[model samples]
Target: MSSYYGLPVLKEPVWKVPDVPAYLYLGGMAGASSTMALLADLTGRRHLARAGRVAAAVGATASVGALVHDLGRPARFLHMLRVFKPTSPLSVGSWILAPFSGLAGAAAASELTGLLPVPGKAAGVLAGFLAPAMTTYTAVLLADTAVPGWHEAYRELPFVFAGSAVASAGAVGLVAAPAQARPARRMAVAGSALELAASRRMEARLGLAAEAYRTGRAGAVLRVARATTAVGAGLALAAGRSRAAGVAAGACLTLGAVATRYGVFEAGRETARDPRYVVEPQRERVGAPGSEVRGEVHRSSSDGDLQ
Candidate 1:
């Protein structure tokens, strides 16, 4: 019934600390590394498998540490596991993180100690099965919120997140297990392609809501991310003859993935900061011609005493 121009209709996200994005980056690395470990095990690439398992364990553990630090207290992290709510991403994520961490830790420990081979291999398999959910659920968590950029891009965010995950894991593999860099290179290229395509589609479809991602600091960061991703993917696919080339490609991919996460988070903040993003859409939806007329009449009658 009231004009909302230049007025914020919703609160921005409270997750302003650096830890949140760090957590997201580390979690993606863990999930993708877990998947790589599973594939390497199946293919009997022992070196690569060991690298993936170690990466998964370290990344997952670091992610949890970030989450706990972000919460301002360790107990809040513990509190998240008090219940298992299927509908809540954070709840489901907590459960997913718990088991995945254990499995990853087990796989890494066994690899290091050269003991308990059978159970460790089983844990790796199970962790791989849960890897997709671990990597992509954070997208759902962000999308479920009221932030315009995040909510509007829900369709493609999962693909974006997954692609970033793959690129990250591939970068780690390239550095940690150079002997088996072929698969990592392939994954990086594929992931970069998917991320670029999905991001383009998301921008094309978002209309006015997409402005947050196209202007200011967020825009610059995203542009750099895209450019780096393309360059990294090209180098990775072509780095067959030189070790230096492989390292450069892997470094670029890792940087691009990190930039993507930060850019996405900043874009969401930009959307929340701009009132037009919130007000104009609601105005279009609720202040159509007929609705505007009815609203005016109601307001006029309510002010009859003044008249």
Candidate 2:
């Protein structure tokens, strides 16, 4: 591992632990819950639909709060909303979040207050239409960074996030409306399967970057995430009208989702902390073998000449 006196090649991400992870988790949950709400409404599962709407609203609101807290002020979040750059993931995410939040709140309010039912349903449908992008755009946002673990896994990260989102939303449904949770159970199973498969495939394809996910704190959390998600899925399959089993599965799934986000964040930080992750990839890109590159230290003289 060649480096300048063992210093990292890339700066660590400025994102904080709990806040950023919470934002990611809540945004995903909100987006997918909106979709679940729409689906439940269409299928005449009124209770499940109402539950989904409330979850979406609360999640979106909380996600925004988390983001603002991380930014250190409310103005910074509002500053982000001033620009609408289509090419920037952050900008697009802000736009998506802004409208989605409003729509979700409106829908939830209407469902709860029994006012303006028609417009509320319309808002729910619109929010549902945007839900897929809302759920997965954070993956794009993370992948857009130079962090090796996130950038290298870009191909599969969106799928992983989407699956996680679906699973989390379904878990909420199971916990909130157990009696009408048939669709939720199926969603939980399917989403967990997808999340596991995508995550495995992402790790396998990450090559050298995969180490970030298999070693240190990141590895420990991800292992727990996988185990819990798998167990949750299995429990969901057998739950079948058992409220206790469903609630237990939901708890496991929620924990798994939270762990996965934190694990990914930690992995990216780990990759950034290691110069090898940055140097080796550059070497490969430039047709140089990893071992051929050597680190050299240079000092500047008083006259600004390198020595």
The alpha-carbon lDDT assigned to residue 32 of candidate 1 equals 95
lDDT of 1 at 57: 95
Highest-scoring model, TM-score: 2
- Candidate 2: lDDT of 240? 84
Summed backbone clashes in each candidate are 0, 0
Superposed Cα deviation of residue 53, candidate 1 (Å): 0.9
Give, for candidate 1, the lowest lDDT window spanning 10 residues: 1-10
Q: Residues 69-180, candidate 2, lDDT per residue (tens digit)?
A: 9999999999999989999999999999999999999999999999999999999999999999989999999999999999999999999999999999999999999999
RMSD of each: 3.5, 5.0
For candidate 1, write residues 1-307 as lDDT tens digits.
2335655567878785579888888899899999998998889888888889999999999988888888889999889999999998889989988888888999899889989999988888888999998888888888888999899899999999999989888887777778888888888888889889989998999878888888888899999999999999998888884678888888999889888888899999888877778778776767677687658766888989435
> Alpha-carbon error at 288 in model 2, in Å?
6.1
Off by over 4 Å in 2: 288-307
Candidate that would win on lDDT: 2
